[model samples]
Target chain A: MSDSVVLSLAEADSLAREVLEAWGLAPDHAAAVAATMVAGERDGCTSHGLYRLLVATASVEKGVVNPAAVPEVSEPAPALVRVDGKGGFAQLPFSKGLPLLVEKAKAKGIAAMALNNSVHFAALWPEVEALAAEGLVALAFTPNHAWVAPAGGTKPVFGTNPLAFAWPRPGREPFVFDFATTVIARGDIELHRRAGKPVPEDWGYDAQGNPTTDAKSVLDGAMRTFGGHKGSALAAMIELIAGPLIGDMTSAQSIAVDAGRGGSPLGGELIIAIDPAGFLGDRVDEYLAHGETMFAAIEGQGARLPGTRRLAARRESLAKGLAIPAAFHAEILDLLQKGKDHVPNPPQGSRAGSNGAGDGSGGH
Target chain B: MSDSVVLSLAEADSLAREVLEAWGLAPDHAAAVAATMVAGERDGCTSHGLYRLLVATASVEKGVVNPAAVPEVSEPAPALVRVDGKGGFAQLPFSKGLPLLVEKAKAKGIAAMALNNSVHFAALWPEVEALAAEGLVALAFTPNHAWVAPAGGTKPVFGTNPLAFAWPRPGREPFVFDFATTVIARGDIELHRRAGKPVPEDWGYDAQGNPTTDAKSVLDGAMRTFGGHKGSALAAMIELIAGPLIGDMTSAQSIAVDAGRGGSPLGGELIIAIDPAGFLGDRVDEYLAHGETMFAAIEGQGARLPGTRRLAARRESLAKGLAIPAAFHAEILDLLQKGKDHVPNPPQGSRAGSNGAGDGSGGH
Candidate 1:
């Protein structure tokens, strides 16, 4: 307790919403972006939290994230949809697309969407969890720029491409698991950089193609694949699926195209949503219940679920007040409170969708 | 080379093909199975090579795998299909289904198939590699009977649930990667059992829910997840996608059903295939080239692509007569040369698809 601060979930969400709004994102997208960020924080994923606001806002300012653009279906099939994110925020397309997939999968059992040209918003848990809430299982994959080395090879050939999965449990925590295929995510490396700490030797190779413990080299070199070639292979596969198949720019090419332009740093995303009930029939309930019983058994001692620790942290914060390091808070207040004059926002009277909430698909 | 045994690839394929034919599998299927199995042996993956033949034959004899059944597409979409294996050997369905996916994806950019009721064969890499050769990237997920523990659960709740990915590279080995999400595949347990060895404590759980080193307990209880809960979450996700979605038997229920019937052991599988050239235009070559360059750095001195070693071994074996272990050769001969009442086959009249040939798909 001595080392913690708390904020009510409501307050944190409100602040997150306000921050996005201030950055000129449409109100609905703002809410999603905010909620996702807060959810990450609540779920204990600080790296993907509010700290990303500045970068996201900067991308929007650069015209890479079109807050007003709407995601459109580029191709349609029973089992898959190709979505053009239209330079909109990644969350918008994912939010809109997931529901559509759920709908179709309910009829057809399973459906997938290939998302192109969207920015990375935050951790993938929020979207998957949201889908799980609708009684559908969901999984998503996204590939960032080439930042990881293939096993035995050096040079950033692949991104920290990550995979996220969520399954509904009967009456327990919705099972959620998300992770980067790389040995270390770029954010983790950044954390190490900020702390002036050395990274694990196994995590990366230096620009010289030699294994090294230096964190800074990761910026210029490559993160090692997780578990050597196994991880490298997985990352490569993820890139293939989430990158080109989604019809998005991939690997070093995307970065080169965006060079100096400071475009939206969003990578490509591929998501699949499945309606378990379609195939499991009445057994869905029993299946999920069994999952919960088993999960609870595993939670026996002092361990926690993949995202539960974050939820617990979030609860504590909500019960108290959100903890913002004094410096970070001061920095936020300075930029947000005083920089309002410099920020550009959409003209005031544009209706924010029907419920005064923006639909998840459309941009600014 | 002291620890290595070199066998000519052609000789290996021929011998394996001979043994499989003796097992009552068609010649074509035998060729494909032999190819996959020997490929693993060639690539240094002894664990998945010749060792799998016995189990496969057992499954066939037990009437779990129909050597003659044809794999058929029950439902088809531009980007997806549902495959009914008709209790055929898993290799046949996978081999057939993979190419169908590749062809459809090439025509439409992406394709996926859910395979139901198939028996296990060899590793999933050969199929992935074939897809890569077809200039398509491939991902395959297979959920078997539960043998791995959930995070906190004492008993097993998932099978090893192997996942694999392969991407075509411009001037190097296709980026093939395959792994079991569990700390160990059940095959490893069987190996330990044969060797009368104890497994590492971290690999499995005891009946009371604590980690144990006894492989026997692991067999009796459950294998531990690869990285604990993270692995469990992944396994759960794979199960949802590969098992229930495929309209095949799933989890404990499926195993229980099999046990009750006293039949062949089998599970469902999900395969997702993407044609990179279908979407990347000229960018595909560049992306692959960049991947190679990146990996070239990591290749440092002696690093190899995930599947390259095996492919190399296959090449070498093809050049030289394959050398089979005296023990395995003896075993195969004993079965093939069984003393009496053996029906000699009219080679030319063998079932058309039964030879186990044609690019490892095992399509009947």
Candidate 2:
């Protein structure tokens, strides 16, 4: 196994933020990005955590992402919202607009927000889980760069196209789940490749359309949808709903438009929020009770809830510290040093490792 | 093979309506139920078609489904509506209230209708397809009696929770897809049992939680969710949203409440409609064009769209006829004959096979 190191959540967050700051990102943008990365690591999603910092830095350096862009949001109708990310990171617009979305849904029973011109590369759970924490039911869909093939099709025509859903359980953590339409996430395949391991046969197909167990072949070819045609239909649904419905590039369009940039695909995301209180009135508790019964039954049968592992990981990580690869830690530290050279004097209290132990609360 | 008879679309519709009428349903309810049954046959969904007539009749006979009850619709908010099924079949309320739902959604950008106290045994596509026909995007979810086990669990904790989505494709038939979260639908398992065929290993499990290919074992035990944990999460989501959110009996509650009824489970359904015109304005056409490009790309790779097979079956059934088993035909005829003894004076034109060669258009 490769050498690894454990960093406190505070240290990880501070280091990530300082690196982004050195890359010329605005304070708020850097903080938002850093928080998401830290949360990913906290939830045991190493692929979506600090590993993405390199790609994000490269994106900003190559002029593909505007580190200083301000997202603009407009209400087209009582229950309709449009947010233009202005070719910036998705977290910026989502952070700025999601509270407004929750308010609108509360006022109108339900609301839909379309986020366009954004680069989204984080785990989807945080956004929906945030809404659920606000006592609302939320569903979110986003299309990424094309990597999954349609069922029975050899060519990649759809993005991994992840979807997230969350339902509030009142005083408890929300019942949250996020998954890509593919049999497994691209990150899992990448991990397998990095570990020099073979994936399962159902994971993906070779370029010639024959099923293969080689993780490298899957990366070179395409991933297959889960459960045959059902997952394919779901991916297609997400592609249309999150893509063209928001007036952003579909998976195919994203490939065509971003071919020269070699950056992560920029597209739109669709989030629909429903205020249960508005519709169910005081009966929301009864609704939650029914959900409890389901959970109890599932537990009695020895089944874990969808987000159980993540929640467990989060608790452990918060209590201890995030175990990250030693080499990866060194790389981020190097980036931080170079970033300091570019920015010269860092902002007050913005230095890496300054926030010892962190608050270990909120922003998850 | 069992003996069978082929009946034209019109003849099939007329026969189904007359059978329901003879069974003491009001004319409108009979028509609505018959339309759905005929649609099921037209789309090659034999399990939901005439094959289900016996169960419908039994439910009505046992008073589990009130054949004479009237559905009530009330708008709780501008964007929210509630339909009380009054313990009747789902078709009555859905057929009566969905048009209003379309109008409300178009005027308000989005709308939701909670359908409670209804027995939704038919396929969900018809309801969402109706909305798509009116140039709207629609999502529908319904929970049934507990049949599917959650991932890693030995007991059934969820229904074969079905979800349907439809998108308007403008000049062509709407793009519609409906599927249960289970690896296979209960009806397909029944068909396998009837045909004395063994299912695939992933289809279901025995009562002891061991994987099995025996259809009888699955029926006696539980169905497995498709796509492993992801599908389980989806089923759980549908159970919560369609069950508790609508204040109806959840899968477990339905099983408890209906234990003595020996009839189809009754629950709630949640339908959400979105009007592209209200949100996207004239760009609706552009949105559809993008969908077309996706379809073209998928087809280029030798992949068929989700609803392709169903649409083809519908066209063929409309042009030629629906071939149904002779034993099932006789059983329906016998039920109709027995029903005639209960209701002496049938309405004018309420006779089996009377509406021959009816106009082969619309509805679907």
Name the best candidate (by lDDT).
2
Residue A249, model 1: lDDT of: 48
Measured by DockQ, the strongest candidate is 2
| lDDT (CA) per prediction | 0.66, 0.81
How many steric overlaps does candidate 1 have? 51
Model 1 chain B: weakest 10-residue lDDT segment is B355-364
Q: Report the C-alpha lDDT of model 1 over B1-364, residue by residue, as the tens digit.
A: 4433445677677877777777677776787678788777777677778766766665555555666667776443345666566666677777777656776667655566777666665678877788888877778888776667776676766777788888777755677778888777777887898788999988888777777788888887888776555566677767666765444544554455455433334657777776665545555665455455445544654566666666776677556645667777677667656412244332221122332111111211
Measured against the native two-chain assembly using Cα atoms, what DockQ does each of the candidate structures obtain, in the order listed? 0.21, 0.38
TM-score of each: 0.78, 0.91
Error of 2 at B309 (Å): 1.6
Q: After superposition, which runs of candidate 2 have C-alpha atoms over 4 Å from their true positions? A: A1-8, A323-326, A341-364, B1-6, B325-327, B343-364
Model 2 DockQ, alpha carbons vs. true complex: 0.38
Tens digit of per-residue lDDT, candidate 1, span A138-208: 78888776677777677777778788888887655577788888766787887888899999988888898
TM-score of chain B of 1: 0.84
Reference A-B contact fraction recovered by candidate 1: 0.24
CAPRI docking class of candidate 1: incorrect
Error of 1 at B219 (Å): 5.2
Residues A188-220 of candidate 2: C-alpha lDDT, one tens digit per residue: 898899999999998888888888999999987
